[model samples]
Target: MEEVIENKFIAIKSHINGAPIEFDFEVKTETISLSAKSKEVIVKNLYVSIDPYQLHRMKSCSSSQTTIYLAAPVQPGQSIDTYGVGRVVASGRPDFAKDDLVVGLLAWGEYTVVEEGRLLNKLDPMGLPLPYHVGPLGFSGLTAYAGFFEICKPKKGENVFVSAASGSVGSLVGQYAKLFGCHVVGCAGSQKKVDLLKEKLGFDDAFNYKDETDLNSALKRYFPNGIDIYFDNVGGEMLEAAVANMNKFGRVALCGVISEYTGGGKRPALEMLDVVYKRITIQGFLAADHTKNYGDFISTITDHLRTGKMQALCDISHGLESIPSAFVGLFRGDNIGKKIVQIAHE
Candidate 1:
C-alpha cells in the first residue's frame, strides 16, 4: 500500500532584482506519495546547503540565456534545488533502500522525490557528523580541492592568496594550500571572519577587506614577494588586486564572482599591463566538470577531517522555515564557513 505525505517546500515568490530578502520566498505544502516511481527514490531531507551561486538563478533571465554556469533561472513558483544530504524513505531502485543516506541536489524542503541517477554520492557515516558530508565532503569541499590542486597547481613553499577566505570554498582552499607547504593569506569581509581564517583555519595571515582602504596595497602587504597562486572566490576589486600582486607565472583558480551577483554592477577595472608582465594564468572552473575526481576528493578530505588534519566549520540554521533567512544570510556575510539548514536530525 502506498502512503501519502504532506511536504512543505520553499519556493521563490517572484523574480528578485537585488539582494534576496525573507519575503522573496514562501513555504508551500504539497502531498506526495511515500512510494517512489520506478527508478526513483523518496528522500527525507536532513540538511540543505545555501550557496551564493543560487542568487544568480533568482532573477528573471531569458529562457534562452545560459550565462550562469551549472544553474538555471528559477521560475516564480518553482521549488529551489541545491546541494543537500538526505535519508532514503522509499526506493524503487535496486541500489537504494529505506534509511540509506545520500547526498545530491535536494529541494529546499522537508522531503523530495528524485531519480536515483541524480544521486551525487552515498553517505558513509564514518562517525562524522552528517552535515560534514554537505560541508567539507560535499560540493564546497570538492570545489576547494579541485580549484586549489587541479586549477592552481600549487607548489610547495609558494605564496597563496584566497579571496572570500572565510567562505565555505575559500576557507578550505586556504587550509589545503597551507597543508601543501604554501604560505597562505586570505581576505574576508569581517574581522571575526579574518580571525577564523588565521587562528582557526591556520591561514598564515588574513585581513578584513572592509577595514582596508586600498585592496591593492593590502594584497601587496600580505604577499610581499607576490602571490604564486590565487584561489579567487569573490571577483571584482579583489581579483584586480590579486592580479596586480601575482608573481610571474602565478596561477589563479577563478572559482566564483560573488561581488557581481545581485544587481551590484561593481566590476573592477584591471590593469592589463600587470597581467602582461606577470604572465599570470587565470582559469575559471566548475566542480561539476571535475566529477571524475570526486572519489579522490572524498578519500583525501575524509582522512583529513577524521584525523583532525582539517577543520569543517558550518553555520547551520534549524528547521525548513529558516531556509529563506539562511539562504539570504549568505549575501549578508552572516555565515562563517558552510551555510546549511538542518531540516530534520537523524
Candidate 2:
C-alpha cells in the first residue's frame, strides 16, 4: 500500500532585491506519495547546503540564468532544489532501493520525489558523517579542488592566497595548497576565523580582513615576494589588491564574488594594466563544469578526511524550519564554515 505524507518545503514570498529576511521565506506544505513511479525515487531529505549563489538566483541576478540552467531564476512559491543528502523512502529505479542513502540535487523540503532519479546518485559514506558528504566531501570540496588545481594550475612552493579563508571552499583551498607544498596565506573577517585558518587549517599565515585598513598594504605585508596563485572567493577590493601584488605569470581562480552578492559592496575597479604588465591569468570556474575531476577529487579528499590529513569544516543547523535563518546567516558572515540545515534524523 502506498503511504501519503505531508512534505513541508521552504518557498520565497517574493523576489528579493537585496538581503533576505525570514519573512521572505514561508514554509509551505504539500502531500506526496511514498511510492514512486517508473524511474523515480522518493527521498526524505536529511541535510541541505546553504550557499550564497542561491541569492543570485532569487534576485534573478546571475546572467548565467540565460545560459546555465542551474542559475535559472527562482520564482516565488517555488521550492528550491539544492545539493543535499537524503535516504530513499521508496524507489522504482533499478539502481536505488528503499533505505539507500543518496546525494545530489534534493530539495529544501522534507520529502523530494526525484522523477527519473535525475542528478541523484547512491552515496557511500566511507565511514564519515553524512553532513561531511554535504560540505567538504561534496560540492564545496569539488569547487576548491577544481578552481585551485585545474583553473589556477598551482605549482609546488607557490605563494598562494585565499580570500574568505574560513569559508567552505576557501578553507579547503588553503588546506589543499598547504598539502601541495605551497606557502598559503588567507584572510577572514574575524580573529577567531583567522586563528582557525592559521592554527587548525595549516595556513602559513592568516589575518582578519576587518582589521586591515588597506588590503593592498596587507597583501604586500604578507606576500613580500608577490603572490603566485590566488583562489578568490570574496571579490571587490581584495581582488584589486591581489592583482596589484601578483607575481608575473600569476594565476587567479575566481570562484565567487560573495562581497557583491547582495549589491552591498562597491564595484571593483580592477587595474587591467597591472594584469597585462604582470602577465597574470584570471579565470572563473564552476565545479559542475569540472565533473571530469570528481573521481580523483572524491578519492583524494576522502582519504585525507579519513586520515585527518584534511579537515571537514561544517556549521549545521537543525530542522527544516531553520533553513531561512541559515541562508540569511551566510551574508552576515555568521558561519565559520559550510552552513548546512539538517531536516531529519538519519
Candidate 3:
C-alpha cells in the first residue's frame, strides 16, 4: 500500500492590485501518495526565493494585458510558484531519481509535484552551500551578470552606479563593477545596507537614498564627472536622477523597477532633453533571455567566489509559514541581501 503524505503550500487569497500583505497568502494542505506519475517527480522543497518580480504574478490581468516576462499570474485558489532548490523524494522520470538534489521552478510549498517541462535546471551543490544555488549561483546571480555585462557594456575605469545596491542582484552588480576596475557607487534604503555596500561588498562609495533630500544632487556628489554606467533596480526618481547625471554615451541596464511594483503611483517623469543631449542608451533585459551565457557566468563567478574576489549574501527565513512575511519583506526593503525561505534542512 502506498503511504500518504500531507503537503502544505501557499495560495493567494485573492488577486491583489497594490502592495501585498501577509494576509494575501494562505497556507493549505493536501494529502498525496508517495508516488510520481511517468515524466513527473515529487520533490521536498528546501529553499525558495522571494524576489520582487514575483509580485507581478500575484496580480489579476486581462488576457491582452497578461504579458509578464518569465512568469504568469497566479489564480486565486492555486498555489504560488517560484524558483527553489529541492530534493527529489519520488520520481517517475528516467533521468531523475530519489534523493537527487535539483534547483528549478517549484511552488511555495513543503512538497511539489513537477512535470518535465517545468524544471529549470538540476543542481550539483559542488562544495558550496545549498542555498547559494538560489542566491548568487541561481537566477538572481544570472540576472546581475547578464544585466551588467550584456546590457551595460561597462568599460574599465568607468563610473558605475547601482540602485537598491544591497539587495541580491544589485549587491552583486556593485561588486562586479568594482572587480571590473570601475568606480562603483550604490544607493540603498537604509544605513545598514549602505555599510554593507561600502564595507562588505567593496563598492567605492554608497549612500542611504532615504536620507537624501535631493536625489539629483546626491548623485552628482558621488559621480562628480557623471555616471558612465547605471544598473537600475529601483526605477522612478532614482532613474530620473541617473539620467540627469549620466555622461554622454552612457549605458543604463534596466534590470527592475521595484518602486512601481507596489502601491499605485504615477510613473516618474524624466527630462528627455537630458537623455537626448547625453546620448544615453537604456535597455531593459530579462535574465531568461540570456541563458546562453549561464555556463560562462557560472565558471567566472565560481572562480571569484572560490577566491575572495566576490561575496554572496543571503537573508533566510525558516519554515514554510514564514514564506508570506519573507516575500512581503522584499518590497519593504526589510532584507539585506537575498530574501529566501528555508522550508527544510538537508
User: Across residues 117-155, which tens digit of lDDT does each residue of candidate 3 receive?
Assistant: 885456888888988899999899999999999999989
Clashing pairs in 2: none
> What does candidate 2 score on TM?
0.98
**Greater-lDDT candidate between 2 and 3:** 2
- Name the TM-score of candidate 1: 0.96
Best by TM-score: 2
Show pairs that collide, candidate 1: none
How do the predictions measure up, each by TM-score?
A: 0.96, 0.98, 0.97
Descending-TM-score candidate ranking: 2, 3, 1
Q: How many residue pairs collide in each prediction? A: 0, 0, 0
- Model 2: worst 10 consecutive residues (lDDT sum): 60-69
- Selected candidate, larger TM-score, 1 vs 3: 3
- Highest lDDT against the true fold, candidate: 2
Model 3 residue runs over 4 Å out of place are 62-65
lDDT for 164 in candidate 3 is 92
lDDT of 3 at 37: 83
